[model samples]
Target: MLPDALRSRLALARRSLLPCRGCLGPVGEGAEAGLCGRCWGGLLPLPEGRCPRCALVHAEADCPEATAWDCGDALWDYHGGRPPLGALLLPGIKQGEAGWRKALLGRVLRGPLPDWAAEVDCVTAAPSAWPHRLLRGFDLSAEAARLVAGRLDRPFTPLLAKGWLRGRQASRTESQRRRLPKRAIGLRRGAAPRGLILLVDDVWTTGTTLLRCAQALRAGGADEVRVLTLFRAL
Candidate 1:
């Protein structure tokens, strides 16, 4: 039998020759050649008509509640029609697939950022509950935050700390999520930085957790707080 390292290398080589994950089609040449042209075209962009404050898609005839954070943007909308690249990679990321995580981070780094993001003075992440982090063997939000900080040339700091596991937000309904209190997340004492702050997370479902983190940052003296996520459940 082939040695494990050789087998792994062979597998990687085979995968490199296969169709791209997004469109299951041939990957054409270029900087983005690893991803097929069709799939690259399919990748969703943040809607231009979203709410200015929360980045929620809004119609001309409708208005959303006042958001707690200053402003936010997401790489893709997570609901309706076919799943986007972020959704396709989420399961692997949750299962601690290093390659998938790296791909997701790269996508985030190359994706568009809100105009105000340029003014962000520092970067941070919404804290993952310790229990969840232990189960996954990685902190998804922290990893994304670190990569985003690197791309932005800003400091990545652990500004918020999860006090306890309030149970998985994914398992809860919208009403249940709305009932979750602001205290579910707390700001790390003395860790909050002055000036504009950018908070990163892997996904946005109910917006409860991000709101709590933003509130904590505000309490800790952040001049402004903004959120950026890989995907937002619509």
Candidate 2:
């Protein structure tokens, strides 16, 4: 255990390191996490007038199959910026940054929550590879779920687990992504999270991961599943 004086000094150092929570930018007096105003403005709420199911723009008429298994509701289209909206998430998922994680969570709160997320009895996250988690010292998806659940005042869960480890998905093409084994995700034995489950993750790419996550939830006795991602790949 750390000595009291040393622990207190370390705590003060950590407090000094955290940025304002609002903007994920710079520190300010009395600011929550050193977030500055300009970075705060970068957060984009989920736009109005999107398909209820997939959150894609559809004819004013809803997609005929909107109700099938539910789909993703994202905050921003991924094409506006050169690297796109979800760019921040890719690095954080592959790398690690507490500040980026906090900003991503803040983005989720600013967006429209899918009915499933709003009504889900509990929230869970897609599990990262154990080796990756060990290297990072934290699971990005779980961190995202915790932040989101805190914002929504709902329960957060870390029940899901990866069934197989795989290479990073960031550089892989959609076709390459499809080739990933079906057993990439699974639920822990006898630890199902029932009811509507809100699955949280940093990014939605090719939709395969989210779909697989939904399947895992369903297998775990989840009656329904909805996704809340920081950004969607265009």
Candidate 3:
């Protein structure tokens, strides 16, 4: 991370070269976040009862009636056009801009999450398949977990690894995404943690990944597993 003095100097340089698109006013210092405070309200959280499993805004409560998807609700719907995500996800993860990591951590800290998250024993990120990490150059989920743990003042454990032979999640369908194989996650070599666990991720589309993570944590002796994600795809 850049020191505070250097970051302030960089923000000053950015203000000179960039202005707020909303007001066309010179974005004073610390406005690289792009939008001024007035324009930030549009990103406020929506109410629940969308998808009980993922907290997505569904047209009706009983979504996809035939399929019985069971899991704790998510915070937002990421599949929908959540414009702010472009400012956060693509650049930070795919492009390796570490600055967005802190920005995203700030958002999650301010966003809706279970009260239990504050009391968990430790935090961990959903394991990504080896191929995706190799191709993407960075593991966005793991990075987000570290940020959340820092903000929440909780331990961040690197206790999970991806299943053997599974590939990138982007290529899989909703059905195929469920039912993670037994090889999907394994504990790191250490004494098993005995209390609650918080799993962090960048986005929650169907929650197939989080559910599998919770299952793995339970098998490894974690008493409880809670999930926190930056966005939920409605």
| Model 2 per-residue lDDT tens digits across residues 1-234 | 999999999987886677644334455553333444444444455557776667666675756532326666766655433223355445744666676666556666565665556676788887787877888887767877887788778899777777544776666787898887768777876677788788877666667777787887887788988887766654
Task: Give the range where candidate 2 is weakest over 10 consecutive residues by summed lDDT.
Answer: 80-89
Which candidate leads the pack in lDDT?
Answer: 1
Reference-based TM-score of each model = 0.81, 0.71, 0.67
The segments of candidate 3 whose C-alpha lies over 4 angstroms from its true place after superposition are: 1-42, 49-53, 57-92, 97-99, 109-113, 130-137
Span of 10 residues, lowest total lDDT, candidate 3:
65-74
- How accurate locally, in lDDT, is each candidate? 0.76, 0.67, 0.64
Give me the overall lDDT of model 2: 0.67
| Residue pairs with clashing backbones, model 2 | 19-33, 19-34, 20-33, 20-34, 20-35, 21-33, 26-34, 27-34
Model 1 deviation from the true structure expressed as Cα RMSD, one decimal place: 3.7
Scored by lDDT, model 3 comes in at 0.64
lDDT of 3 by residue, 1-234 (tens): 999999999987866767654445565544546544433333445364454445655676566522222334444444323235434444444655555555555665666666656787898888877777887677877877887788789888877777657765767887777755756667666737567888777776666777677777788898877777766655
Off by over 4 Å in 2: 1-40, 59-68, 80-85, 106-116
Per-residue lDDT for 38 in model 2?
47
**Poorly placed runs, candidate 1 (over 4 Å):** 1-41, 60-63
